[model samples]
Target: MKESDPNKKEPIGKLISYIHRTQLKRMSRSLGEYGIGGGGQYSFLKAILMSPGTTQDQLTVGLKFDKATTARSVKQLEAAGYIERRADPEDRRSHQLYPTHKAIEFQPVLQTLLDESNAKLTRDLTDEEEDQLIALLQKLNLED
Candidate 1:
């Protein structure tokens, strides 16, 4: 066991870490049930949909993924016909990401999965508690 340092600790780490781990597992299972397998693909899909021509590098940096993994995952999605890489009118060297019709077809399914996940997570919490939890997560993000 590692020695404990009395001076060191985040007051909220235990609850925060539990929430994070549980969220990831639930997200994975939700995506798995939807045939998306939850991964960088989910991030990529969301990023591209929000800013329809985002570059691979933008995804790598924005999503905090390694460049190679981002590239490979994009390639996989491309092969699966979920997304397309188009020449960026702004930059000849970088291609932009766009969702294909195939991906759009899956949007409703994905949304249902998200709705279920959200309902499960909030089933026992009041509206105020949900808001407080979100505020706490937002505070944590500001720390980063």
Candidate 2:
């Protein structure tokens, strides 16, 4: 009898990491066309799209990223013309980030890529299984 691959029994972390790496690679290619690189900037842009005029501090907290990391991503996005930062009238020391027209125009394309990738990943699963998987993943991400 042939031996089964031990990797088949690898922990969920390995599988999740693999998926994240593959998605980042795909995003690097797909988003490069739009002048966005991998480095987690996709999520940052999406967050700004969802809430225009969000503060840098808000982004740091919302994304669970360090302040410096958020600052760097914000700077890159701003320089790339995907986002514009304006002084927050409410908070003189902080700035609010907003997606520019260029970034807004790429929303559908990004959404399509996201949807297609998700469908491809869950293609073999039934609706119930998909829902259960989503629920389980969400549970895992929840703060204890």
Candidate 3:
């Protein structure tokens, strides 16, 4: 078998996966002190904070996570004192999620951490390049 060319461009999926893993490591380290679990947990918390009273189903769909992942993240966030679930009057089987006072107080810090992480991720790129990269990534259909 012939060896592949080292100069060949990597596949987009591989590149995206690598970038995702790197981002997750950075986020996990940054959020460890605040009791937020790594990966999608902080994303779930942010969504709940931004839109209180959202349901788990909504989060699952909006965040593109499976139902079980959404449920698990919510549970972890609740146990960490960042969020609470209240009974939904409209649906007895479902609960609405809300950020607790702890989460509210930490919201600004959360935003700052996220901003710093993003800035680090794009530090090598010019502002225009960053904007173009964002636009190009957004053009992909990453649903499910």
Candidate 4:
């Protein structure tokens, strides 16, 4: 195959990958200002959003995290007032993980931050271009 000419078009994939990762890290740093950072807290918040009463073992499966790490993360999140664990009446040793009032209140801010980040990333694209990009990505998914 002939090598692609950089003069014709820049390497969009590589640029997007680098910028996306960097911007994600930077955007997530804002979470620290609200007393949340690192240690699987982001994953924990996302999991609780999807599964309000999920158990730690369930989190292990759903989030693809290891046992010890899952336990440690839950402990930290619980202590931070981001989540609450309720004792299972049926299962003596099992506890269900749910979002705290504080976390529930913060959901809109999370969504706004995500929307702002997405907007920043795609700020240069027109509506038609955004549609085309999404379609192309979906087509690539089919190839995989």
* TM-score against truth, every candidate: 0.75, 0.87, 0.93, 0.67
lDDT, model 1, position 14:
73
How many clashing pairs does model 1 include? 0
Q: Whose TM-score is greatest here?
A: 3
TM-score of decoy 1: 0.75
lDDT of 4 by residue, 1-144 (tens): 367686787566766677756675856686778766665467778789768999999998887778998998888778878899999777979999999989899888876876787788789999899899888876664221
lDDT of 3 at 144: 48
| Model 1 agreement with the true structure over 1-144: per-residue lDDT tens digits | 266687988458775676656766787776764445545466677677678788999999888888988988798778777789999888898899998887888777766766887788789999999999888888775324
Give one digit per residue, the lDDT tens place, for model 3 in 8-60.
Answer: 98789987987888888988899999998876688999999999999999999
Scored by CA lDDT, what does every candidate get? 0.77, 0.86, 0.91, 0.79
lDDT of 2 by residue, 1-144 (tens): 256697678678878988878877877787887788777888899999999999988998898888888888889899899999998998888888999998899889878887887787888999999999889998896453
**How do all the candidates rank in terms of TM-score, highest first?**
3, 2, 1, 4
> What's model 4's overall lDDT?
0.79
Error of 4 at 38 (Å): 2.7
Best by lDDT: 3
Per-candidate count of clashing residue pairs (backbone under 3 Å): 0, 0, 0, 0
